[model samples]
Structure formats: C-alpha cells, structure tokens
Target: MMGGRGEGVGCVGGVGGRRVGVRGLGGVFEDKCKEGENEPYRGALAPALALALAPALANTHHHNIIKLSLQGNVGHLVQQHAICHGNLDYKLEDGQGPVLMTTVAMPVFSTKNETRNRGILLGVVGTDVPVSELLKTIPKYKLGIHGYAFAITNNGYILTHPDLRPLYGDGKKRRKPNYSSVDLSEVEWEDKDDTLRNAMVNRKTGTFSMEVKKSVDKGKRVLVLHNDYYYTDIKGTPFSLGVALSRGHGKFFFRGNVTVEEGLHDLEHPDVALADEWTYCNTDEHPEHRYLSQIEAIKLYLSGHEPHLQCDKELIQEVLFDAVVTAPLEAYWTSLVLNKSENSDKGVEIAYLGTRTGLSRINLFVVPDELTNQDFLTAEDKEGVFNADHFPLWYKRAAEQVPGTFVYSLPFNTGSENKSVVLASTAIQLLDERKSPIAAAVGIQMKLEFFQKKFWTASRQCAALDGKCSISCDDENINCYLIDNNGFVLVAEDYTLTGKFFGEAEGAVMSKLLQMGSFKRVTLYDYQALCWVFSESSDSGHTLLDPYFAFFSAVKWILTELVIFLVEFNLYSWWYSDLTAKGYNKGKRRKRMRKEDG
Candidate 1:
C-alpha cells in the first residue's frame, strides 16, 4: 500500500504495477491482507493519490506527518508556494527540485450535483512557465536605435526594462528573483518626477517628457537630452507597456534638422525672395504643412515687403512696367482729390490697390504721410506691415471685377478715428498680353460721412427747386436710406443701420421697396401704420424699425383673440343648456299640477 505524501507535494519515482485499494477515515488508512500476512508499505504516496489529496489538505491547520509525508509519518521535503490577491506569483519549488517558475492559477471545481447548483471547491489547477522561457516573450524596439520599450506590473514593479536582466542567476543554479520587489524607477533613471511609474501603477495611458544625460563623442563630452514617453496598460493583464523616444531624433525632426538646398529654390532665389516674404501667408511651413498665423503673416506683410509673383519672368516684367506707368497716376489721383475737395473739408482717407501679377497678389499701399502718423491704427498694425493676402475680401472683389468698372463695398468702420468708410474698387485688365490674362485692381477708401453730406446737399438743392419737395437732414417726417441691389442697407440717416439687411429694418415695406426696382421716388401714405415699433433713440431723426418685435406683437394679438373666442363660446354653450333645462322643468311642473287638480 502506498503512503501519504508530504505537504501536498508530488513524489516522482517509478513504482511497480500493482492493484492497490485502501479505505481511509480521519486521515488514517487501513489495508487488508490475505492469509495472516499484514504489512504497511511506508515509502511514499502514489502521484495520483497525492494529487487527489491536494485540494482537501490545501487549507487544513494540522501537523500530521502521516497525512503530509507517507515515509513512516516523517515529513522531509517541503514545497514553497505564494498566495496573494490579484497577483501573479512565482514558485521556488514544486516537489521536483527547484524549478524557478511562475504560474497562472485557475480554480478547479467538481461537476454540479443535485443539492448544489455549482460544484464543490476541489482545488486550484495552475500552469507553470519557466522564467527563462518568459524572458524570450518580452518585447523589443523594432524601429529607431534611440527608442526603447518597457513593461511594469500593477504594483509599481519592474516586469521588463532595457537595463533589467530578464533571466536571473548563474548557470549552475537557476534562480528566479522576486520581480514584484523591484520598482520600475530603479531601472528608469530618467523618471525624475516618478510620473511614469505612478501612471503605470494607476493604469493610466498618457505621454510625458523627461531629460537624460548621455555620453557624446565617445565619452569625451556629456549632454542632457530630452526624451518623450508614451505608456499604456497591457490588456487582460496587470502589466503596462511604455515606449520612449529621444525628443530631437523622433517625428518632426525635419523641422530643424533639414538644411536648405544650395540652388534656385522659390524662397531662396533672388527674384522670388521678396515675393516669398510678401506671400508667406499662402506658403505652408515644410514638414508641418501649415501656414503662419494671420497675426504673424500680417506683421510680415506691412513691413514694405513685395511679392515676386512666383518668379514668373514675364509677369515680373509686366508688373514692373505697370508700376512705372502707374507711378505718376498716384500723383494725379492725389492732385484730383485735392482739387475737387479743396472747398469741402472731407476727402479720401486712404487709397490702396492690390495687383494680381500671377497667381499671387501684391499690395501697392499709398497712405499720406500725415495720416500714417495719426493714432488711427492699432499699435500692432502701426508697428507692423500689411499683406494683400491679409485683406482677401477687399482685394479679390476688385481683382474679379470687370475692367475699368467700379464696385462698392458696404460702409465699415475704420481705425481709431471712429470714422466709417466705403471701399470703391475697379479692375485693371492687361492690354498687351492675351495669353497671360492678368487682372490688377485699385481701391479707393472714401469716408461714408462724405456721401451722407453729398446727399444732404442734394436734398437742399431739390428744396430750392420746388416748394412742395422741401426737406431737412433732421426731418422726423422723412426717412432716407440707400440699399444695395441685394436689399442690404448701405447708407441710412442712422449710421447703425448701415450694414443691416433691408428686410430686417422694414419687413412690412420690404416687398414694396424690392418691387420698385430703380424708381427714384415712391411715397406710401401713413407709412407708420405698416410698422409696429421703432427705436426710441432721439439722437437719430429716423430710428431703425424693429421687425422682430412687430412679428412677435402680431402673434401675441392673434393668440389673445383666439383665447377670448374660446372662453366666450364655452360660456354661451353652458347658458343655452341651462335655459333649455329650466324650460323643460317648468313644463313638467305645470303638467303635475293639472294631473293633481283633475
């Protein structure tokens, strides 16, 4: 008969074939003999029997060498096993000499029975892996010599790192170290703030930057290098993976590492250098493929920079010839403005033009020296330069216009002067080159108040012509407004209504004005009756009408009338029903009295 094993450890020894049957009760076994021959086999328990008793003896609190080891109740060999909550443990020994391995344990259970839905707690079954074998599975960097990957456990322990030894011990004795005892920061020296270790322990995924000192020029010099790290947890496990890269050698290295080629590059070529600086807003910074910010681009433009029109030799020559021809036109424009507006104080504040030489644009800005010295512009704008690309709306409108024909922009406020101005644009088409169709344009920024004054003077002239058509600039009875073709108010007595759509100002009269296309005068009798409300501001003679308020007022009136009608209808129905019931009751009473008298 085989004996009991020691400490639930398996015994590995060849045994002769024999049919053995034994009865056991309270940790004692009895074997029956045949014909007065009785002896107990006290060597070691069979491997199968030892495995069967493992689950029962796993949690027992007893020191029975008979139940532990079967060699005459004397326990010799002991097995060392670790048990911790939510932790993967390594074993020192498992009955078969020192194995030095880790295990993944799964709870083994008996099949379900009639009394219980789930099986009984039999024991734990575990799969063992040698530490040496597990070392081979640890990952390594596949690309870039400077970058490396590492792994750590949930308890801030180092599972794998570049500097950490994967397999521990000398060749004679294979030993596994307690990996959970080693902290990750012990190997990662660059983790000065301990951020990486904390993030890994907390199971967080993010990136951080750190600095490391490294030997340079074969240990002749040492330099501090910036490093970036990205870390995340390994799913289905308690470990995390961390990847690190040297900051200067990773992605976006081209931002500073690349050198300019020594050739006629667009930004480097003599003809295109000025143009490139002027049109830098359109050019993307290499590697990133993004243009400079508007604030930065505008600053570069206003510093007297000019574009070379993409180094087009023909286009450059044409623009140069045009500039020569238009040089005197600037003086002529200035003279005409001074000659015409000498009697009146108001005139053009600034006159600038953007010429489309090729695909790019160049601004030929002309602001009088006296006006430029004023605090009309913001501090930054006054300090920096201007680019035609910065004001695309003003430039593109003129560039796309028909040649020599003028188009006007809605009046907009300009500068610290608090004066409103309108932009008048006219395109200048090329005459000599039919193949290269270039459309240059000029813009004259005139004060909006100047136009208001002109209209006011015309009204006075009309009053002088006819007695019935008398009107004043501040007349409350008359409201004057000039609208664009799209019915957006451009000029109004109230400057606040300048940029508003016509429909928003007068919804009731909007259809009438839209239908009367180019008619000079069309009067509506009792015009105030069409509108519900007007602004109460007394400074402006003709206040802006609020159509939204009128629409809501009309809706409120309709709802009030509907509620009154419903209430009156309900009251009339009740009154009619009560009167009919009273008449029927009076008739019944008269018939009862006649029956009683009869």
Candidate 2:
C-alpha cells in the first residue's frame, strides 16, 4: 500500500545550469569548416565508404568516444584534449577521483588536399557533463527528508550514470561491480523486478514502488519508486523512460488521477459517523442468552402448518413484532448472534450490512436446534464464501433497495441425517430519533419451515411500502422479471413476468467515448430485481451512455485553445511595439503618409 501524504503539485524543473551551452558546442564542432574555405573536394569515396560502414554512429555525438570509435573498424588515437580545462573538473564531486575523461585526434589522410602531410583534427567537438551534475535531474519532493529522483534506461540500466561507489555500494569494502553501465537483467543473485522490466518492453506509463534489498543499508528496507514515462520521439526504439525516485521519506508519488485512497485520509469530510457505528458493533460486552421458551408461546395462537411445533413459530413472530414497537434496536451496524460451534462453546455468526459509513458484519440470531454447539466455522470454512460465487449473494441483501428476505442455506449440516438448513427472514425498518428510516432489517431466526413462509409475506408488505413490485414462489428455480424502458423484458428467465415494467441492465453498452474530463453522472432505473443467485451475473459489463459529455468536452478544448491564442497574440503585440510611441504612432504615420501622397 502507498503511504498517505497531503495533496501536492510540482513540475520538472528545466534542464538548467548546463555544463556546455548550445553556442559553445556548435562552435567546437564547426571549427574546421570555419578555418578553411570550400575547395574542389575529390575524396568523396572515402567519406562514402566510412558512411556505408558506420551509418548508425557517423556524425552523431555520444557519451563515450572510445566505445563509438571501436564500433566502427576505424583505428583512431584518443587523448584528453582539454578545451574546458578548468570548467570540466570543477563540477566533479570531492575532486579526488580520476579525471575519467578523454578526447580524440583524427588524422585527415586525403587524396586531394595535403596528401603528403598528415593534417589532424584535434577537437572531437562534444559536451561532457560530470556524473555528479547529472544527478540533479532527480528533485527533492518534501522537506525534512532525503528524496532523490533519477532516471534509468528501459532495460534498467542507470543511464544518468551516478557514481557507483556511494549510491549502489557501501564505499568501504563491497564496491558494486561497474553498475554505471550494468543492467539489472544481468544480475543473477538479486531479485530483478519483472514488473519494471515489462513496463519498459510494453512502454507503459504509471508509477510503482518496490523494496531494494541490494542497498548498502542492510536490513533497513529501502523503497524505490519507479515512475514509467512514454517518449513518443523514441517510440519502438531500444529505449524506454523510467524515473526512479529514492523514497527515504515515507512518500510515493502516483503519476495520474487521484486515487480513492489518496483522497481518503486528507478529505475534509471523513464520514466518521458511519465508521464509528461499524467499529462499535465489532466489539461489545455480551453473554449468550436463549428466549426460545418465551418466543414459542405465541406460535400456538397463529394457524399451525406442521403437525407439531406450531406454538414455537408464533412466539418468535410476537417477540420480533413487539420488540420493534417497544424496544429500540439502535442497530446502526450489523447485528450479532452468539452460538456454539463445532470447536468452541461460543462463536459468532456475522451478517454484514453495508451503509454509508462502511460495510459491517453482524449475526443477529441464535437458534437452539439449528446450530447448537458444533464449534463455530473454522477459518477455512469462512474463506470458502468470500469468492465471487458466494459474495454477490451477500451483496444483494446488504445493498437492497427495499425490505426483502432471502432464504439462504448455510453450509453447516443441521438434521439427524445431517442435512443443510436455510434461514427465512422478515425485514423490519430500523428508525432514527426523527422517525426517519435508517435501515430495514429484522432480527428473527427460526428452523420451522411453516413459519419460514411468513418471510415472503413480510417481504411483499415491505416491498409495497417501499414502492417495489415483487413475486415469490415455493419452487426455488422460479425467478422474478422486470421491464425495460422500451417495454422489453429486462431479464429473460424461465419465471413468469407480472410486473408493471421490465429491464435487466441499464442498457446495451455504447462504443462511443467521452471527451477528456467530461462529467458522467450515475443514474438508477427501478425494476423488480430477482433475489436469487441464478438471476444475478458478476461483471455485468458497462451500460450505454449518451455522447453528450464527449461532444461538450471537444467544444471546451477548442474554445480554450482559441482564447489562449488570442491572448498570447495581444501580449506579443504589446511587448513588440515601443511603449512610449504607441499612442502617437498612428498620428505620426498619418502625417508622413499625407506628405508622401502630396
């Protein structure tokens, strides 16, 4: 995870304080042409032959002349022809290292001019900046920290050419084996990041960080920031751009849009109310209590479905109904239920309900026979339901539009034959002090199948109150249908469609793109969404959007550029003309024009 730092904005300071200016470099390269006048040059074949052989290197300036000279089969003597004698060495740090510098003397053996005498061009004509000076490209990001920015070649070579002794090595005994020209690909003993390597090959643009175990600071993990940039001019070449920032201070810079995490900690409104409710519900003081005998009394009054246990289901309903009318279940977060598990005497079953603050897990019921002291679910069992198959089932309930009940069977075995049991729930509205609804949920649990049917009735009542059309069935395979804006079936399934309208997704996805920085608002269309897993699909894909945002963005960009052009033109006119003569220039020009006309 990237560490949090406040929002900031900075730019790459220009490549200023250059060792050799443009004019100086140009003068050195053109000195030979300046000394002599144009002659009838007849040694064109010699120059042509040289070009044919070293076409890639010919007439191009590079970092090392020795490497370049060796590449072309032309044998030439190289020596340090000191031009910027004092200026070159002055830039070196500490000034104790060898003047690791050199120049060249090319003998002009021509067939036309001065054939007998060996006239030599002494100056190689190039700019040489110290390695220490090259390190300036990396800038410090914040105060009270040592943050250095550097650049590497696409192949992970240190192209900026930092002194290997201090940066990569400890400088005492263990010196890095010529890291100045080495690529990470050649290092077998160290961990070569495949991520950084792939970024160069694919020419990606993004920011990433990794720990550098090879650092001289042993055991102290050093975080290195790798910010990839794409260079259009060097596209498809053997080089890619990578800016490596040394993060000694706990700050990492992301290149593009502000992420949710980046905006989270520094946001003025942190949404603490919902967070506090979640945190409180996660921990509390409680002892396991059973009210089965009290709840069973009311069940005998309601019509009996099974041959026995009729009284038990009725009592559970009255207990839930009276609790809402009299007792306040401030239930801002998830409800919790304590139970005995297969391994432990007491364990919690959590049902998570997500609100504005955060998604919370609460299990509100503990049934006697359903799961009495089997040892709570093991860690492996909990992880099984965290995947795409089971998680979406949980999402439908936690982020419901209306009061709904879903009969989902837990993986645990319940009956004497060890059959899996399911829970049917009746959702009740939880209200705030203003009597406004905060959440819709009911804390009722039962094993009786007859009482379970009441959950569907309660669902219909809650749905009507919440303005949702719904249908229920005993056969689990049957599903509900909704209508789209076009009156077409929103989702096509085997279940019968009796709803007012139908639509499944927002609409078919549109291929049209939006202009840069266009505002796209989220919209919701009401439909009877089926509450079963078979009805829902993961990664449903995108929805069709109108081209309005893209159209507007183009107009904004054009207008902005036109305005900028006009403003720049006016500014240039003001700066170019003589300020003192501006007002009187028209009058003076008119008099001069009249005289000329006369």
Candidate 1 lDDT, tens digit per residue, 264-336? 1222211121222232233233422245442234334333353421122333333343344444555655576
Evaluate all candidate structures by whole-model CA lDDT and list the values in order.
Answer: 0.41, 0.29
Worst 10 residues of 2 by lDDT: 9-18
List TM-scores for all candidates, in order. Answer: 0.30, 0.20
Whole-model lDDT for model 2 versus the true structure? 0.29
Top lDDT model: 1
lDDT tens per residue, model 2, 396-473: 232222344442323221223222223223333343222122232333223323223444455457555767544454
Task: After superposing candidate 1 on the true structure, give the runs of residues whose Cα lies further than 4 Å from its correct spot.
Answer: 1-310, 334-344, 358-391, 399-404, 411-418, 430-438, 459-476, 515-598
Residue 57 shift from truth in candidate 2, angstroms: 21
lDDT of 1 at 228: 71
* Shift of residue 596 alpha carbon in model 1, Å: 68
